[model samples]
Target: MKMRARCCLIALLIILNWAQQAPATEDVPGVGSLPPEVLKLLQDLNRQYGPDTVTLVSWLLDAATHSGSVLTASVRVTGNEAREDGTFLVFQIETGLIFNTRVFDQSGRLTVLWSKILAQAFAHLDTLQIPADGVMIDLLYHHKAFAETDDLSEHVDEPGSVEEAKFYFPGDPLRAFLGKKLSSPALLARTQVFINDTPVPYGAIRTETANGSH
Candidate 1:
């Protein structure tokens, strides 16, 4: 009797945890699960890179429509594939990525909130695979408070302003891929650039003076 009770309790806890970590469908059904454009982009990405190289760098969510819409998605790592030799996929938000070879068997595969994953991914970048549709990849979404931008007021406190910064990016997906391997906090901390605050003609500074210190 005691063993049966323990098993039942464990099953109940697992179900509760799953429900909390991931909702049935989209958080809000009417919102329509990421716009057509967004879905197209994700499809193109999966088709192009085979879900091994493309990643979600950062996600930006806003209270719009019924619930929220993925505003912008940023991808940090990209390649035809993770490289024949294979490479590491870095997260812009936190650190590590959870990998699932059989992604579809799992419903909510993308779930992880840890900084250690970030450090390890970067460290062992040479040998790792991005989980496919059925595969699972842990990410840093719950600990969003650690990121400065989680709070609007806390944004832009780091160094540069968004407008002044110019970054080499494939696309911004902070809004599209929040809890996935491609999106990471650490990568975002390094990638985002406030372009407005940047000096005009940054690389092409005029050499009017001999020093060229513009």
Candidate 2:
């Protein structure tokens, strides 16, 4: 009887090991289709910022634009809310001192919290030795109401709104911009703005010399 009980326990352990190594029976709703590298990065971010605080919706990288001297990329991110129920913050990082940002807020209450993740993304890109003539970043605050939910399916199909603004920086100011703390208003003042792709005429938006302006 003792030998039989020991064999049963050994069999249970083997089953548990197999279960742990097996893949999930169903994919995670929004992030299941992401590339393995991207999924790993998102998992790392979540581990740092509490579970489900940020989700990477999509990312594109292109180096053919400038004979390989420049890397053009776009990234879209959202809060923990359902993708259709929240804002999509889009970033267009390009060559030279210019970059573009657009905000598509599906729900006015939706906000994006991505400072840490963005920094990491840039750091990873830096590994390629891409020239940094300048940098453009979109900064925004997230509402507490945008916290994660266990059931994202319920938020699907919710009606929401959209807003977009683009800012451009001129000259090779990447080094200078990276050396100091970033301020959105100050940076905006120094940039040329476009709403829905229409350029805002000079002086239409107030301009200010950023502290340690590049």
Candidate 3:
């Protein structure tokens, strides 16, 4: 009888272990859906990032846009599938603000609180053409980056004003801006921004005449 009891205990342990590691069920009738409460949680998380930060106040289509004060965000639901790492909903966030150092970690499933904002860490608008003509927010970069290695680089402030600024040379607009906005003035990574044969944005500003008067 004692031997039978031990055997039963062992069987129960095995069953529990299997249940614990049973792959996450993402499609059990709305288990993975972005329900109202979950959406509210994401907004609250962003609030921890800043006072003006927010998410969807109202539901919209899969191809939707979310905006922040210093940035903008857009998320596109691609397909109907179980939750899996790298099965992204797709987001695009942009900014023109300078002097910020934001760290983001939004790679999760249930709580799509999947975004962060760094207003003061932004850089390099003088060199990078706005990807599109509009405001953007909290859209995290999808690439990994190295820490800054230097400490004497000048900061790039004021979009469309500075002549030259530090950045990760040869970077696309997104990378170029982050390289300067986030890491400049500290000489991080020996990064520098460079033009890639694209024409610079044009604007009109008051200029001194040949006679030396504005």
Candidate 4:
């Protein structure tokens, strides 16, 4: 009888261990359950890049829309169907603002391709009745290639690297930046550039600079 009781105790302990190790389930919403505008934007992106290539990886929405209140969405593109492979696209959901950090070509520079992608996202987001003035763009630049699992924050604070540039502008300034006529200097003048969380003058970013150095 003691042996049988010991066996039952061991079984109980095993069951308890398994229960502790099991993942807890939460009521997380699926991609399809996103807001109608957001869902449409994702669908349009998927169609543009081929079916099942674009996936909504993560998002944070504002509890209530207010100035400086931000909603962000992180999207991943799988396969080489588009030039955005291995890159994550982050969007300001409220303002239709978007940007990506991945360097697309051998030039190792931010290119017009980003502008085009931003335009596409903005077109869909413009339809939403949200405050455009609160829209801001925070761009991350790095010499290293980002793996699919890499966290962006890890690179932002790396010493000696000017990894971030932020711009606070309404739709018109953004439009001007996207337009061919507007020069980068004008955009830079309004931009608040940063290096390792330290603020730097916009002029520190030069056309010929590499590795985000002045």
Candidate 5:
């Protein structure tokens, strides 16, 4: 009888251990269930990169709507589909948004934010397939705290002003991208020009030479 009890105890212990080690869906408010594949991919991404990547991904998953008009949905990462153009990952941000990719690409704010985020965590990812929707939706509406802006135009010093002039980027998403890629003033200054609908310029230097007698 004692041997029988011992065997039962061992079986119970094994079950308990297995239960403790099992993986579960991450708890995110307002977010729906994530596919097992997506959860696994997220773990891999977090392990390879860091928490920032995870945080950004989490926000994307949890975002439900923007401005009460644009709809958001749970995202899925599917296997790469081979193509002659290039290899790419298909991130289906829900079936609803797939047709609207073109609209979203037009917004300056959204494009800047999306480009910056991708560069930080997914730099190695050369090609990506998102929803075909052409609207920016509400990706950054509530996450503005993460978005930053520097209006250095007002701080530009006059010809004789003692104050040092500064370069400012008015775009919030650009600021976030700069904050991630640039660690020093020199790097930021080097990237002062970028092409948009037109050439956007930042920073100006005024030089004066003393008169010389012939």
Candidate 6:
């Protein structure tokens, strides 16, 4: 009887070990259908800013112009709700102030910029130490004018007259003026905006004058 009982226990342990060694069923659905660039960008962003913080907002492989394709993504900063990582991801409905670092998709080759934005977002999270319940109440306050005017990079504190002073009032319309007036790619890249001494990201300020030069 003792020998039979010992054999039964050994058989049960072997079954348990077999169960532990069994391969798990993969349930990743619909990921194989994504574009090569999109998949690559997703993986890059995930590595930069923990998983699920960056999502494929939109993609246009053929934008039907000189520009080849356009890829848009969002990097969540903070919100009232909580994510699985104990952080909140929020998007504004009234204003398009979703991500902290916004890169204009000009030539379909700004995947590097997308990764930079995700990194910046994670850095912001580390610097701020924002709580789970914290909402981004200051997003609109910082981005109100630019959101209304579609300006790429502008500060909130600068006076509206500075826009007129610099001939940048009604932002998009002034691009043509600057394109003609300042037709040097080297100069444009060096020209510093007053905000953070940060020149606009490459491809963010594409102009007809400086189109093929760079």
* Least well predicted 10-residue stretch by lDDT in candidate 2: 61-70
Indicate which candidate wins on lDDT. 4
Candidates arranged by TM-score, highest first: 4, 2, 5, 1, 6, 3
lDDT of 6: 0.27
lDDT of 1 at 190: 26
TM-score head-to-head 1 vs 4, winner: 4
Q: What ranking emerges by lDDT with the best candidate at the front?
A: 4, 2, 5, 1, 6, 3
Error of 5 at 79 (Å): 1.4
TM-score of each: 0.24, 0.29, 0.18, 0.31, 0.26, 0.20
Give the candidate number with the greatest TM-score: 4
What range of 10 consecutive residues in model 1 has the weakest lDDT sum? 60-69
Q: Model 2 Cα displacement at 54 (Å)?
A: 18
**lDDT against true structure, model 1:** 0.28
lDDT for every model?
A: 0.28, 0.31, 0.25, 0.33, 0.30, 0.27
Q: After superposition, how far is residue 93 of candidate 5 from its true place, in Å?
A: 1.3
Q: Tens digit of lDDT per residue, candidate 6, span 15-86?
A: 223333433243223345445564455444334433223321111101111121111212223334443333
Clashing pairs in 2: 106-160, 106-161
- Write down the lDDT that model 5 would get: 0.30
lDDT of 2 by residue, 89-127 (tens): 233432111121223232211112112223223222212
Instruction: Report the error of model 1 at residue 182, Å.
Output: 22
**TM-score winner, 4 or 6:** 4
Candidate closer to the true structure by lDDT (higher is better), 4 or 6: 4
Residue 166's lDDT in candidate 4: 38
> Which stretches of candidate 6 lie above 4 Å from their native place?
1-28, 55-214
Better of 3 and 5 by TM-score: 5
